[model samples]
Target chain A: MLSIKDLKVNIEDKMILKGINLDVKPGEVHAIMGPNGSGKSTLGNVIAGKEDYEITGGSMEYLGEDLSELDVDERAQKGVFLSFQYPVEIPGVSMSNFLKQILNTSRKVRGLEELNPMETLKFLREKVNMIGMNEQMLKRSLNDGFSGGEKKRNEILQMAVLEPKLAILDETDSGLDIDALKVVAEGVNALRDGERSFVVITHYQRLLNYIVPDYVHVLHEGRIVKSGDKSLALELEEKGYDWIKDELAATV
Target chain B: MQQTVIDINKEAYQRFDALFGSFEASLNGQKSNPFHQIRQSAFEKLNTLQFPTLRHEDWKYTSVQRILKHKYVLEDTSMTISSLPEVAKMPDVDAIRLVFVNGVYQSHLSDNLNQVEGLSAFSVEDAMNHEVYNKVLSSRLTSEVDENTNPFFQLNTAFSRSGMFINVDKNVVIEKPIQIVHISQSGDSPKLSAPLFVFNVEQSAVLNVVESYISTETNSENPVLNTSHCFYNLAKQAKCNTYKLQKLSDDHYLIHDIKADQDRDSVFTSFTADLGGAIIRNNINAIHGDENILTNLYGVLLGLGTQHVDNQTLIDHAKPHCQSNEWYKCILDDRARGVFNGKVMVRQDAQKINAFQQNNALILSDTARMDAKPQLEIFADDVRCSHGATIGQIDEDAVFYLRSRGLSRRDAMLMLQLAFLQEVTDFIEHNGIRDFMVNNIVSSFEKIV
Candidate 1:
């Protein structure tokens, strides 16, 4: 469902992602592990069509359509979702309204029937309950004065409501307690299926325990140096990233 | 030192001298009437009071030199109050109707409000002819004029010809707000009109006044100037709410001076929304006269084109245990400029006072300008007084966040502006008034974005 060939990205004229190649098919989950400044989050943002990053050279195809030609909203409409590392607080837009707008916009862009207010409300309630958020939280302004855990849960609720084809979780586990991490993972696990795919990006392997990725890739200096099964995450967590850095240096 | 002193009060003295020489003898003859005597005293106080300048801490960012330099001819005779344009078609609001055309009462356009029990509403002419009007003004306009803080108010009394007077009897809760409509019309020439409005709330009585300014005809080349002074008096245990809607055209300049006095256990709430006018200056002052008094003031100014809106507010806690809250917001687009100055003062004896003030502005374009200053002066150390001011563009992150949800860029900006101004619009107590305010806000947004 997602494919990238020699993806290169530059921010402020400084190369962040150089020659990154990855592919994820439906019915599978992929996890990317990298140390600080290893270009893990930068890859996710570039895929999500952030305008600040210049895609120097790349061909990214999602669901048989060229992703580079689309803007952020267009990419989102095509079932590409990015869970931001930091969820922005919009002071006056309610969570339910924001979620409804996203869902309807996505549906409309795909030539699907749009849900009415009542139908949207029902969908939002079910997702709210599934994500363990109170109805009052949905009524308040989006992310305004919300705790870190609540903001992460809010992002997960949005993902569930939109039901995107490919979701890139970027540091959703950071700043979350163990309980919050489990809740967020549970929300992600609930959406796991043969027709949906996920790209989990994190430094720790703890979130992988709950989401349970099918493949693990170690990213270093904007290149995927190692690729293996789920056990690779466990091994990297145990020995840390230096072991992989040493192996790459020895190979070079 | 002598040169500096002379330069300090140059503009103020010129204005004072012009007004004094124009109407000193006429005001002296009308002192036999108590209201006229009060007016005369106010004129004397205007002479003693000095106009604040950039040196003043609160007026540091605002410049009023141009306003003071122009010698405005205060017209006494009534100008033609032409029929208003059919654009603003609102249903008849069931309240006491008072009409002022170029600062003169237009009896033809007013309804007979005397039939309403316990409610006395009429133009200054009605009060001038009736014996009971003297009684109402004598009991209502009973304020010892403050010279320093409100010099323009005294000037209003010194120059105002006819005024709007309303009295809600004791223990009578007025359901429908008293509506006073002031309309300015452009004729063959430009004109200047100064009107003074007074509303007296008896003990335990509730009064809501909806005062709106509308222009019947707008001529850019021959524009008119309309200045208004309004004083509100709430007795012990009385409640009063004032909502002023300024929707004049771009061909008009309005200067409004509003003074409100709250007695012991009284509550005064005011919401001022400025949507029109070429240049509008609003000066609002609320005084908590006794202990346990409460005061709340909120304002929103949405301007487009070359419109300029300036709001200055002062809340004085004179007695102990008073509370005051102030919030003002503005949205400016094109070449519009907005200014806000909110000052909260807690007196020495006014211990345990609680006062909070916030002034926030959002500039939509690079050419738009916003000047906001929130000032707090606390003589008593035991009071809770805080003030904050912010001038910034809309949050880029929030805009991007909304745009990612498929809202067009223009729609996202309009939503943000609406939410920013709704904080003040929601303070309208009456449903009809609130709807009117909402519609006005939406129209202003439409013109800009």
Candidate 2:
């Protein structure tokens, strides 16, 4: 579903992501874990075409097309979703309106008819219910004064509504409590169909227990040093990230 | 700079002298009327005070030199309101429509005046004959204004002939709104019109007044200048809401002044929407008399092309426990310019006063400019007064968020700009009026890139 070859990224003359390579097939759930400042979130942002980072030397192909050629919105229209580490708070725009615009835009881009107001409302209600969010929350301003957990749930609700082909969950479990984590995981797990791919990025192994991943990769210093199965996350949590760092230092 | 200043003042005086001669000739036997003294004083004041220059504090950001240079004939010809464009009428809302053509009242175009009990609507000439006119006019006229402060208001006071006089009796609530429409028609000649309006709300009365300004047959070379003045007097426990919508042609100039006085427990609310004009300036001032007064001033200015819009507001809290809130927003695109100067004053004896003022502007183009000045003066110790002003472009992150949701870049920018304006437009209490204003705002966005 996605391919990256020798991905090299930089921001303001400082290299963030060195030469790195990754590949994912259809219906595969890949988990990327790393400590702070390990460039885990940068990979998600670059895949979503955030425009701030400069791809010094790299090639990202999504569904056999060059991803760098498309803008952020174009990428979104083409079934690419990035659940932001911190979702932006847009004042004066209701969540329902925001969701409807995105869904209709994506549908139009995919050669589908746009939904009317009533139909859109119904669709939004179902997706909102699936995410276990209050109906009142959808009517409020888009994340203007929402709690951290509510923002995460809203992001999941958007992901469910859009039904993106590739979803990148960047730190979606950072600020959530146990209950919120369960709800968010349940929401994500419900959307896991046979054709959709997800890249879950986190700092801990707690979220893997809920939405178990098909593969686990440890990112250190912008490079994937190790790749394993879901059990690797439990082992890394029992030990610490320093063990991997010490081993890399000894190997270098 | 000095040469241009001297030339502007000289031409202004020459034109005013010529216009005054024609004005006096039209008065005929009414020269001996009681208002004649007031007009004479105002005329003398006009001659003594030169037109405002950029050196003046209030006129620092705006210049009236171009408007003063035109040779404007006083438009006294009366035309039927039906001759005006259909856009002049707001038909969706149930209102008592009073139409004025070239600053003169058109009785044929007005609705039935007897529909609302205890509500009196009349032209200045007809109201002058009534006994209550003198009392109402003398109660608040020229109480808070002078020639030194606003020369255009002085000009309106000096030459206003056919104006509107509306009064609501005590304990009466007018169910329908009263709309006063001023339509200017200048045919191949630069025209000038001065229209004054006086509104009196008796004790415990409730009323809403809407003033709309529009023009027909506006010529670029022969521009029309409309200098309008309005006075609103609210008695004890009375509530009044005034809405002014200025949508003139691009070649026309408008100078609007509104003065309001509130007694004990009276509430005054004003909404000013400036959409189109070459140069539009709105001066709003409110003064509290007794205790427990509430005042709200909301304004929205949208400028395109080379249009210039200026809004200056002042709220004086003289009584104790009075509250005043003000919010003004502006959207400028192309080479347009906007200015906002809001001032809140809490007097020495006005203890426990709460006053808040905010002005925000969004510049859509690199050439567009905005100047916002929010000032607060608190002389009382037990007062809570705050003022804020922000001049910025649209938020990039917010725009990106909308774009990420599949909106085109243009639609995203427009959505954010409309949201910025909704903060002020949402204060409209009438649903029909609010929707009409929102539609106007949406259409105005189409004119920009």
Candidate 3:
């Protein structure tokens, strides 16, 4: 469903991603584990068509179509979602109204009829309840004053609402507690379907305990140095990333 | 520094002189009243004072040269009420509407004034003879003088003989808002419509007033100029809310002046929304007459095409324990220009005062301009006063956030613009009026896009 071949990215004359390659089939969950400054989040942002990074080499193909020419919104309309590590706070825009606009716009792009206020409320209430969020949060400004966990949950809620084909969770478990992490993982697991794919980027394997991955890849120095099964996550958690670094140094 | 001398427009002065003669003739028997003397002095002052130039600090961003070049007529009795353009009335508002054609109050188009209890609404000429109105007018006329030298205000006072006066009785709350609609139909001639409105809210009374300016001359080669003045006096513990909506045609110029005096423990709020006009200038001033008064001045200006909207506001905190908050936002598109000059003054004795002023603008086009100057002059040491002014394009981060959520670039930008305006529109106490204003702002934004 998604393919990245030898991706080299730079931002303001500084290289963030040197060379990266990843492939994901439909219904597959891929976890990308990396230490700090390993460019895991950059890959997720580039895949979501963020404009800040410059793709120096290679290409990204989503559903067999080149994504370099598409805008952020166009990519989103085509069912690509990125759950930000740090969500933006937009004041004066209520959460529900923001969601309704996005849902209606996406629907319009897909040649579907728009939902009215009542229909939108019903749909939002169901998703909101499933995520165990307070109804009052929907009336507040979109993530304006929300806590870190609340923002993460709001992001997951947006993911469920948008129902993207390819969802990228960029450190979604970074600032969440154990209980919050389980709730988020459960939310993500509930939305998983046979046709949807996810690329979860994280530094630790604690989140993998809740939502198991089909494949685990260790990203070191902007390159995917190791690829293995879900057992790799448990091994990394026990042995740490020093073994991977030592192996890379020995090969060099 | 050498003092520069301003040359007044001779032709414009001649035209104003002839119009003033006509205005005096229209007054007829009321020429002997003391108010007529005030009009004569104001006319004299207007004649002596030259039109403000770019050298003037207050008129730096705006120029009256185009408006002064035309020889405007005072009265256009040739046009009938049916010839005026239709203004969509707000739905679900049980308002008492007073319609005026060419600055002349049209009783036929107005609702029955007798239905309102504890309220006396009449033409200025008729109200001058009543004892209650005379008492209020005599005391307010002296207090109503403009603090600054503005030629338009003097000109409006000179020619505004046929105006309206409303007096609310003590402890009476007017359930329905009084809607004053001023429609200018200058036909082919470049006319000047000057209307003066006076409102007196007695002690413990509550009143809501809305004044809307509109024009009907769609094909006139020369632009019509409408200069209107409204004076509101709120007595002790009274509450007054006034809204001024300027939606004239693009071929017109509007100068609206509103001054309110708040007595002890009274509250006064003014909302001015400028949607359309070639050149629109609103001068809103408020004064605290006694201790513990609250004043709010909020406005929104949406300018498109070559529109020019200037808002000059002053909140004078002369009494102790008074609080005033002022917020004005503008959205300028195309080559439109917006100007905001807000001043807050805390007198020496006005201790324990709180005053805040903010002006924000979004310049949507390369040629669009915004000039915002927020000034605070506090003579009292024990006061909290702050002012802020921002002139910028749309927030790029906010735009990107909206776009990333599936909105197009244009929709995202428009949504952010509306959100910026919503900060000021949320201050409207009446929901119907707020919605109407928001809808108007949205439609205006659509035109800009």
Best by DockQ: 3
Q: A211, model 3: CA deviation in Å?
A: 1.7
In model 2, the runs with Cα more than 4 Å from the true position are B1-3, B29-32, B81-92, B101-109, B142-148, B184-186, B215-218
* Full-model lDDT for every candidate: 0.80, 0.86, 0.86
Error of 2 at B268 (Å): 0.3
Candidate 1, residues B1-449, lDDT tens digits: the string is: 34453364676567556766666565555546556666667777776766657776655655555445444555556454555344333454566667777776777766676677788876554565567656656554545464535566666666677776777899999887777788877766566677877787889999888888888878875666777887788899999988888899987888888888788999998999899998788888898889999999989998889888989888988899998888898988899999887878888999998898888899889999998877677788788887888888898777766665556677678877887887667777778888887788888788774
lDDT of 3 at B235: 94
- lDDT (0-100) at residue A216 of candidate 2? 97
lDDT of 3 by residue, B53-120 (tens): 88888888898877887878766544457533456476666789888777776767788756789888
Model 3: colliding residue pairs: none
> Which portions of model 3 miss their true places by more than 4 Å?
B1-8, B25-35, B83-87, B142-148, B184-186, B216-220
Q: Find the candidate with the highest TM-score and give its number.
A: 3
Q: Assess the local accuracy of residue A229 in candidate 3 as a C-alpha lDDT between 0 and 100.
A: 95
Select the stronger candidate by TM-score from 1 and 2: 2
Instruction: Give model 3's share of reference contacts.
Output: 0.50
lDDT-superior candidate, 1 or 3: 3
Interface RMSD of each: 1.9, 1.4, 1.1
Q: Given candidate 2, what's the lDDT at residue A239?
A: 89
- Model 2 DockQ (Cα-based): 0.54
Shift of residue B107 alpha carbon in model 3, Å: 3.1
What are the per-residue Cα lDDT tens digits for candidate 2 across B1-449?
35687687788878888888888888899887756666777777777776899999999999999888888887655546555467666657888888887677777777866668988877665666678776667444544334236888878878888766888999999978888888867667787889988888999999988888888777889888899998888999999998988888899999999888899999999999888989999999999999999999999988999999999999988989999999999999999999999988889999999999999999889999998888778889999898889889988877776666557788788878887888789899988778777777787788778
Docking class of 3: medium
